[model samples]
Target: MLQDHLLEEHAGPAAETEPALVLANAQVVTAADSFRGAVTLQAGKIAEVTDGGAIPSGAIDCQGELLLPGLVDLHTDHCERHAVPRPGVQWDPLEAAIAHDAQVAAAGITTVFDSLVVGLRDADQTRRDLLGQIMAAVEKGETLGLFRSQHFLHLRCEVTDPTLLDQVEPHMDHPLLRLVSIMEHTVGQRQFPDAEKYREILIKLFHVPPEQVDERFRRDAEASRTFAPTYRAAICRMAHARGIPVAAHDDETLEHVEEAAHLGMALSEFPTTLVAAEAARECGMATIMGAPNVVKGGSQTGNVSAVALVKAGLLDILASDYVPVSMLSATLRLTGDDIGLTLPQAVKMASLAPAKAAGLDDRGEIAVGKRADLLRVRLVEGHPVVRTVYAAGDRVA
Candidate 1:
């Protein structure tokens, strides 16, 4: 049985008086169109959208800013950093959750999945110890209405860990658990095709000695070979049985994409090569790339360029990854002349596409009857800055 105390099924704010809202003189970006329009919100849903310069009486003047659907981030590592802000410092669990929530809300993410590692192979004891604590914190915060954005859980299972299955089972029935992704970040495979680069990255990330890197990599690789295949299958079965969406992480080959499709994965997260992404699309799996990758112009690890994939029409969704602000930033960047995506198309990737992929059908668009999660954004010096945010018809930021 799932832990009842640790899970709450979409416990949103209780019934209350929610005032109607209206923002006129804005560029309303929807799932299929972008038009100069006004959006009206009533009872926590979009009541109406009027096209072209029709400013209703008592409506807030948006002053020709972009009124976009608030972003839906399928994956973000932002919260974990707050859980342990520094190498040895650990903040209060609930405090960490609220702090992360504030940042994500300000970044225009109305819905976010907090990515938590189910298992870790390295010597990051702090992270390993804080996983359950953070999960509990998210639940507690949601129940208490402490979060500004809707939060869900995305368990990133590190298949190389022998204890991965054990660690994952407890959260299988968590109400907030919406996504599970099987990952094998062992070295010289998947995300780390270049072993030396992987070593350097891990050295900096874990602050380990150079001399100890090779031995650790060898052990990790051996462990992955021993446990990954079996654990991957088991984790997928568990997630699928529970009706949770499972994603494939860092797929780097056609074979990898094929296996993920065979396992019935719904998303290919950060496929490391163009071939892999193309294969994922062919296999009918939606491809998700890091928003930071687009913002930074390329993958930090020298994988396939997200811009290249977008130009090729192979990318379907954008995840904030480690940067909460990158969701809107990347969405706007995709609309530039170089990328060539229209404003509506770019907004859909960050909002509607991810929401639909994660089984969130009620929000993610500025259409009538959808949840009123909207962002008022203005471009100042070519940077998209969010001025106001509304989630469920309530002003959150």
Candidate 2:
């Protein structure tokens, strides 16, 4: 059974009150259309959306900027970068939380699932223990209302690590633990179909000597072969019991998608090939692609490009992955491309679709009775700039 102590510790206290804020004279993007409008907020929830014109009492003028539903990031390692700024350097968890929160808010993400890897083959014991502390700080920040965005935990389970299941079960009941993605980073497959490129990237990431890369890869490959099935079963059971959404990452084949579907996983994140993505779609899973992949014009791992997937009607969500700013920028870029998507459709990939996939139904669209998470952006010379950000009707940036 999942531990309940972690949940109790993280639940801190109840919120006292909800503040109201209104935004007017902006072009609001709804599920249906984008038009000049005003959105009214009451107790941190959108009360109404009206035609653009005279300002209502207590409404702040948006000055015709484009108002969008705040971006929902389903996968981001930005916080992990803060926790480990360098190979061996570590920052205070609270300090890292503050820095990452501010950056994410400034980038117009009002909701983020901070992705942390659960299993590491060569990481020191101290580094593994830091995950608990980092998660605790995130919960504390949310409880104190000190964060700019709603922070949730998404454990990236390394299914090739035998110890992963043990570490993961203890945190399954964490209040902020909302999502999990089963990932196997074994070389020569899935995301890294090219062994040579995989070797190059792994060497840089692990700061390993070039000469030792091949030996380390061989060892890791053998370990993955041994642990894959055991880790997969454990993760599926734990996630299902806790009622958390599970995702399969870097899927490369039809069988991969079929297996995830059998586990009742609702998301297929970064399917490496078009065949995998299409198979995921057939299995009724939402396909997520990296926004950076779309912006950079190709996949960093040499997989099918996000734009190509989008054009083929297989991609449903766009995650910032490593770069938070790329989320909005890529959406805008997609609007101008020949992907048969309008501004609203493109925006949905970055905002609405992710929220839906994460089971957050309250704040993805500009609709009444939803959390007033919003972003005010302006397009200047074909570049998008975020002018303001709000989470739960409170201005955060």
Candidate 3:
């Protein structure tokens, strides 16, 4: 298991009596620049950052590894995938949460916003039943400090479902409900403009029965036509009332971007085309692309490429979406020759940018007074590897 593998590494240097933990001899990547430096942590926050090759006494030697701010993922469907590992297999909620946390922390993520799907009436009943159970378990795990990473909620609401408003109303005010995204996967629109591709996704990717694809597609299309407007409006209003930021998912058209902007969405999740991404920029909305898209060089659903968005200057944040390890991999890939972004610039898209988008200002950079959430990473055979992880100045993974 991944948890056992990560647990086998050494935690760090022995305990110090000076009330501060220093990581020296690191290639630190800050929000503004990268340098060979040392960082000090005290009282669960970053106390100081020093530029040089100096190694303070009693400091943990980083051995020239990369020191990056812990990643903040605004959208990740990882927990849901863990909760339902296969078509008919459902793991226990608390156990799934623990497994997901371990994977996320091992991937260099310290703050994770677990995306939970809601208001899918035609989907698997097992998945629908696990939503509340997963949320409750995550909340309990966070409260008891039973996990390595700090978990929050990102509710992905399907506006085509007429009961969407009711399904999300109770969670709107939940303290951990940090983000809400409105999306409708109607055939021949937005993400699934091609009916053939949509059919393939339903049967191959989502594991929907081939015999039931047409019926489900028709039902979803009809529901989208009838209920999308009202349900989308209601969900947005409810989220706005409590000051939670809303995101628009898989926007493909100029009008869709405009409507989402009018609804006061903070970000656009996975804009499916260049025009939509540009429109989002015009509307003062940040664009979030999936990390897997960057790693794989294209979207799994055959939409826009994340590298294209970077070249066009339209990408703002990077979400792991379904693959947690892709976060750090995508960050490093962006600094490659094809994309041509500096290490610091690439790291910000996964860390500071997402943190700011989610209204979290305290723990995204290697600066004084910020939460000491950091990652010790190294390159193994040219692939970035997470060596150790710390959250709020404590070594967690």
Candidate 3's residue-wise lDDT over 1-397, tens digit each?
3222222211222344538989999999999999999999987788899998789899999999999999999999999888889877889999999999999999999999999999977666566767889989988787667889888899999988777777777777666788999999899989999999899988887778899988988889899889998888888888898788999999999999999999889899999999999999999999999999999989888999999999999999999998999999999999988789999999999999999998888778999978789999999987998899998888988
TM-score on alpha carbons, each prediction: 0.95, 0.93, 0.94
Better of 1 and 3 by TM-score: 1
After superposing candidate 2, which stretches have Cα over 4 Å from the reference?
1-20, 56-58
Error of 2 at 195 (Å): 0.8
Q: Between candidates 1 and 2, which one is better according to TM-score? A: 1
Clashing pairs in 2: none
What is the per-residue lDDT of model 1 for residues 237-270, given as tens digits with 9 covering 90 to 100? Answer: 9989988999999999899999899988989999
Tell me the alpha-carbon RMSD of every candidate: 2.4, 3.2, 5.0
Off by over 4 Å in 3: 1-18, 124-126
The TM-score, computed over Cα atoms with residue i paired to residue i, of candidate 3 is: 0.94
Q: How do these models rank on lDDT, best leading?
A: 1, 3, 2
Worst-scoring 10-residue span by lDDT in model 1 = 3-12
